[model samples]
Target chain A: MPYLPTAQSFLEQSRLLISARPTTTRITTKYTLPKTSPPDPSKSKSPPPPSSEPSQPHQPQPPKATLTLKTYDPISGTCLKYETDKAAEVGRLIAALGSCGRVMAALPAKEEAVDEGAMEVDAPVKEDAEGKAKAVPKEKELKGGQGQGQHKGGEKGGGGGGGGKKKKGKK
Target chain B: MATGHLSTDEFLIRLATLFESRRSVNHGSVFLTQKRLSPHDLPKAATDTPLPPSSPFPDLHPPHPLPILIRATNGKSKDKRKDKIKLSTVIQADELEGFFMRYADVCKAGMSGLKKRDRSGRKAKGKAKKKKGASGGGVEGEKKG
Candidate 1:
């Protein structure tokens, strides 16, 4: 009798197994991508005058170089110009290279840091009389990177680490 | 949107930079898209918005990112026609801010080193290596995404 067990007990065991079945849950997503680009939500609202930039239908072109890093030869009358495509990269490049050399205007503008680049142009700016150089930073950073956030102190300790160890070439 | 403003490579670079900062949490919080900017809100400065006849300038340094906008294309025709395609670049303002903040110090350090390079041509090469960094550690983290 014990080996066979009761029919009621068997039914209860069967019910427990059936109830233990794993359930599949489906995740619901709200965002549905449209067939085409989503319309600008702010289009209906009127705003200031739009840029006169040519809007002839075409692929959006890659951005152009805004900052020009020009290195002037002190002895010679020649200069090497480096036109960086990104203002941010130029900033990073200058930071990586250390000492904007003579091209302090190349510093990422809008930062509160003491810009030696702007300082070097101080005389010329003063001479301009129009005080144009003072506006140079803002003019350069027209892409709206607000330099006001957190102040990273002493970025790079104000100097490139000591000179690289020159590899002694064998004759 | 596929404005194709910041390419995958560029995004990866930013991602690498943000990770290097050890601020991954902040990085994840960035939304890939922003409420579409008005065409008029586009930057107005010449340097800021130097749209030209063509954009095939060969530059010395690698091309970095620009402030992405939901711009209208005027010449979307291979047959020499113009039509602005409305697409959004995968760049968010906060992400850009975070990237700049993370690399700001690193970039400054790089700039600081250029002074030494100006002194000696041979040493300049070494300084360049140093600026590239990880040379001292025997392994410089590749400056890529």
Candidate 2:
């Protein structure tokens, strides 16, 4: 059986999560639906193991992929499980739910920086500086002069270190 | 849960209508996650393959993809008390690929529609040509010519 999520149900959702792996891809949506009956036991608790276990009763079974759509409403407390292997059905549900909002990739910031570093080891982050230099050539010259002045001030501060070194030597 | 599936056209229409209705509210977010397989967790056959002889860092270019686990939370400041819903279903790679492609198109359509609506709203507000610099000068210059 295929799970047909309604437009109203889609609007009622607070969060939607789609996990895509090489072998298995899962689409899960959490709805803050209005509570009707006493919450279903399966809603708060983990899914029953029996539901998953009964599917594979035979031995020497080959690796066969199955699409399972599990809808759990927190209010109703009823967890509906639908299983299908049809590509068309799975694609349709994904397309429908996916359109509700934008799909932002869950990539970590640190790993992306590391990946960029590994790929472009020699490339320096000078694009912004170069672009500013090109657009405002006068500003670049002013900045260079300011940098030189700061360097000269630092050199004078280094000369003052001699008096401090003499006091340390006396101590 | 509805038992019967909707046609592709009807499904898109319903989604668009829902989106239009929910545009004003802070209805929360939806995102996609993709996991990359790490070399260590890969199958023995994939690990057995040799790297290219010309490369310096052979370890960097592993034949097997890296295993990356991506966790998606609601927002930057996650609520500790609220129960985060976790649900996942397993499907084949080919079907998943098709979904991603279609999802991209859907997002593009949704974004373009929103942009069009925003432009119309701005026009209604009479905020056109609020600029006072080069753009304004250019308009005056063209009129004089």
CA displacement after TM-score superposition, residue A98 of candidate 2 (Å) = 14
Native-to-model Cα distance after best TM-score fit, residue A20 in candidate 2, in Å: 23
* Residue B97 displacement in candidate 1 (angstroms): 4.8
Q: Per-residue lDDT of A104-129 in model 1, one digit per residue for the tens?
A: 11112233234423333222222232
Model 2 lDDT tens row, A1-171: 235454223222312222112222223432111232334666757655667555866434322223333434333343444443333343344443332111122221111233233423211222221222355445644664676689789999996796467445643
- Computed on alpha carbons, the lDDT of every model, listed in order, comes to 0.30, 0.36
For candidate 1, what is the TM-score? Answer: 0.21
TM-score of each: 0.21, 0.24
Per-residue lDDT over B1-145 for candidate 2, one digit per residue giving the tens place of the 0 to 100 score: 0223344344445544443432333243323333333444345786686445575634333443233222222222366426332212222222333444554454343322121223577775544433433466667778999
Residue B64 error, candidate 2, Å? 6.5
Candidate 1 per-residue lDDT, tens place, B5-112, comes to 555345445534432332222111111222223223444652465444353522111133223221112123576444223323333333444443443443333222
In model 2, how many backbone clashes occur?
6
How far does residue B9 in candidate 2 sit from its true spot (Å)? 18
